[model samples]
Target chain A: MISPVKVWRNQKKIQKILGLYGIIVSWTKVHVPPVGFSSQAPYVIVVVKLESGKSYIAQLVDWSENSLKTGQKVKAVLRRTKNPGEEGVIPYGVKFKPV
Target chain B: MKISVLGAATTKFGELWSRSPRDLVMEAVNEALDDSKEISLQDIEAVYVGNMLSGTLGGQDHLGAFFAEELGLHVPAMKVEGACASGGLAIHAGVTAVSSGIYENVLVVGIEKMTDFKPEEVAEALMGAGSDPERDAGASFPSLYALMARVHMEKYGTTEEDMAAVAVKNHYHASLNSHAQFTFPVTMEKVMESPVVSSPLKLLDCSPISDGAAAVILSSKIKKTGRNIFIVGSAVATDSLGLAERDDLTTIYAAKEAARKAYKMSGVGPNEIDVAEVHDCFTIAEIIAMEDLGFFGKGEAARAVRLGQTRLGGRPVINTSGGLKACGHPVGATGVKQVVEIYRQLKGIAGKKQVKGAKLGLTHNVGGSGATAVVNILKG
Candidate 1:
């Protein structure tokens, strides 16, 4: 029997803020895989508060020693993460880079 | 009907390679049974078991019944899950049962077997406490707290050095605790230089995962025992499960509200608390909790620690059992183990780390990034 598939309303329209200026709220240098997830060690994981008055959790790209601070200004870029499943199908998400 | 702790026991908390969850539970149960022989197995009318991630890590659920049957008991039993506050919640249930006249004797057990899985898998299971988007994006549990630590640093001028100091203090206390997982005294320099798990939070700042269990019996037949530890206050509160949804990220509303309710119920203010066992899953968490519990003003917990106000003989002697950071967090068993410490301290059998004249004690257990907070007060 076929059942009607439901789709997300997307009513809370998330405004993707690429190249938007944001400040770091909190961050961690992820050194190991979390659960079933894998990660390249020492990657800077951050929570960025966008100028739009919204906050997001993201990974930092182009990171450098002493580059990321609590109030450092950063810009978000659409980036790709490793494939969630297989077949090299990767998903694009926002990642902050020091501006 | 009043509720009081009839007996309490905890396994030596640490990485137990030789034990399973069931074995740890039996160990704690037998100890509790021996500690207070007044309440026997048949006297236990029902059981409330607390556990988190057992289904994922131990591949088991229906734990309350499993535990009851494992112990050869014939009574209603069930599991309670409130992230890291599971043990606190279980005791709350037991207290309610005994206080409401529904049962004369109630049993509460909190257990977790974290070492059954490999390190990364354990990290994955711990992510169950985080926001869906955050966890899906690969934010580990420590990262969630690191974010909080960052905001705290930005808002209050708190330093990484202050965060390192918490580890130093807890390790000193843990050195006195035989059941502590990490009994060695850690220095501030070592904590600061330790490999960073999350930027301001080092590996030493976080709690170690271990296998352990704790149990307590709550009874209304308090007159039979010449001495007693009364459950004076019990309260639990909740907040937005996801941090993004909260109006304020700097403060945990659940803890604030729960502490408020417990204090009100017990008619005991923060100044009156003699000793306390707070959930210190991370060093920043301890600071936040002390402030939320009204022990200090907002953003002042760090300074209070720096002043040596929270040491064993200091102000209220917080985390005399070394806290999760040193005592080891079995997750589910943490809350109950806290009560065991308070109980022992109140009975004057806490050995070396005993507060000089502690008469009032409090326990604050938090679940998942402040999503659930349980506060209980005891008076001797």
Candidate 2:
């Protein structure tokens, strides 16, 4: 399924939270849990803005200081969780990668 | 109908370790009673207890009856919860109960014990404050406010320094409060250099997990002997629990509405408030609060705070008791604690941190992000 940000951008009002290349509105390296249900441990999270201007929070791939910066250009990608459920069911969904 | 706060008291805020939730409540209650022996224990007809995580955090529920039984008072007792606003909402209920003539003497207590749990466990417990399938996306609590901080910066040129300034100001205020959990001062450099809990939000920006309780005894029958602190206006409001659901991230509309109703009821405008106790659960909260409560423009709170406008002798002397940030937020106890500070200041007794000769004060409490807001105007 598309990320909530994408779904929201699909709405008429926020059709552009995504720009030609989505922009990073905010980014953080969270060491705490209960933040993302599927997140295993410390990982980089970013609220990426779509070309339509709708903002969505998802994990950042190719994570590095050089890889991510505020207002940096990025695009959406689907990635799998580092940790799987007890049943070994791996969840896959939206993530962001540098352009 | 009219209500008077005969007395107010609070336990020193911090990790009590040995103090059970019941112990803390009884301590605050007894102090409040001792402050006004004029009102007999038998005269208190009802009790309203505000607690956010007693059931989950302490494995205790039915706190109202529990507290009453512990005190050996048979009056009807009940619990009130509104996330962080639990304490303030309890005050509202207790005041209304007395004002409605349903009870002559009432006890309103707000308590929270949150230090026993581990960090992850605490995060899990706090998650209960937000809505599921929405804000509870496993995002860390600070991340929510961090997002707001970034947006406020992007949208209005608010800076990282602006947010850290709040921590600096509150830490300084806390140093003067004997009961504050964190009484040591922190510099802006320290706040900014602190490890990042979330982007743009550091460890210093958050209110610590604290254990403490605050209590106030309200009575219409008590003789007006000493300083009479009256509750002239009380109001509460709610908004969507999920932060993302809000159309705008910069403002907490519930606080605005509650303050509006409170100001209208008290016939006191924001400018007329000599002092205020605001919910500064996070540094960003205080900024948005100043804006929502009409103390500053939409994007001007940070700049105003930087100019020392919210400091002692500045603007309205916001958070003279160090606020939840430095004073320690014991969840359900915060609302009562804020009132306690107002009571002292209005009575011209806040010592060094006192806003001198303050006759009117406002206490603004918010639950979760902005899900619940309570504004009460008090007069000397």
Candidate 3:
């Protein structure tokens, strides 16, 4: 489980990147995920070149095969990063979706 | 450059359920001491232990002191960690100590016990080497390498079959290795048909989680005998922890930089390296390493590997000990085991897997995606 304090501190950072536009530089579909991410197995993760000239790595949500290619336009969205288990903070983070 | 590896030894690499960390260390260290007839445990002036997941999985840290006590030593000891490059870093430390004239003899051991935890737990702990954003995206180690594989495929027309050949070749080499995790050669078809851990990277492309220990004795006091192996180069380089931050996904700049430094220090170009044990955590990783290490030109490694240019009979034969793919990757133990493999080869004692007239050898170890790399050159 993620620390509540840490999650809280990361919220502001997440807010800054929210709704940002980007282009996919590279992508991969994670068939096997680590702990806390089993619920999202087989998720697409992408390296996105953001409009602000920064690069980010995040899950590509609401994606289809057509949207999973290099240079695909995407926008960052707020979403639950992982299952926090029982009595843990529901951590939200930035995920990219086909723009 | 004056430091020599007086002795090197490794425990079997695999899911050794019966062995504890203490058991593995004692076996490897004692065997290493035995290998160097001129040295004993009492002669070790310092101890450097390399480990990655002991505290995360086993909830035990302070491995340097822990192993020192286990070996009945009261010398100065400390643990070294650089994700998977922990072992290589520890060896670098030992070389620095001896070359600096701070100590004449030192013990460096790399060990990891991963079978004790669930696969997911082990996967999660391994991500400690990666960036927080990568972990937040639920990226496992395979996924990280898979990303690179996808880009390589698109840019160079590298095929899944090319990657599969890497597994087939490494498994073939592993078949000749008694201590390998997988002692049977795998067919290319078998590797291509294996279940995908991540797209473009099948189960066969990834190294198995293993339990093992490797120990090496470094000494400047050792007499220069006919069979003595000397460390000609020891260098490390670091880069961005996350793949997204890298300027190019097709290369690991840290590895390139480390290899560059190692070559310059040893005054031995890639052509002179008769044998090499490179980090093959993933098939794509080996391909990229080949290019980064200057053994092959950019976008040429996949084809070269598929053509058997890196096989046992090939020039500068790579991963003769099965590499991490078939030899088993015990994280921390891999870097040290690479050194042990080269030491054996240089000493002309690496039976069956020995490279003929191996005068010079190199070992490459990487941590995280491309965040850290350690390169070492040895001369027989």
| Predicted complexes: DockQ each | 0.51, 0.28, 0.89
The TM-score of the first chain in every model comes to: 0.75, 0.65, 0.95
lDDT of 3 by residue, B154-202 (tens): 9988899999898999999999999999999999889988998988799
lDDT of 3 at B184: 99
Candidate 3 Cα errors over 4 Å, as ranges: B224-226
Q: Rank the candidates by lDDT, best first.
A: 3, 1, 2
Model 2: per-residue Cα lDDT at residue B178: 93
Candidate 2's iRMSD: 3.5
For residues B12-127, what per-residue lDDT tens digits would candidate 2 score against the true structure?
Answer: 99988999888998899889888776776777899999999989877899999999998899999999999999999999999899888878889999999999987666776886
**Candidate 1 lDDT tens digits, B84-148:** 99999999999888888889888899999997678778887887887655764577778888878
lDDT (Cα, tens digit) per residue for candidate 2, span A15-77? 333233687776667655652343455667776666765566666777778975778888766
The lDDT values for all models are: 0.85, 0.82, 0.93
Proportion of true contacts reproduced by candidate 2: 0.33
Q: TM-score of chain A for candidate 1?
A: 0.75
Worst 10 residues of 2 chain B by lDDT: B131-140
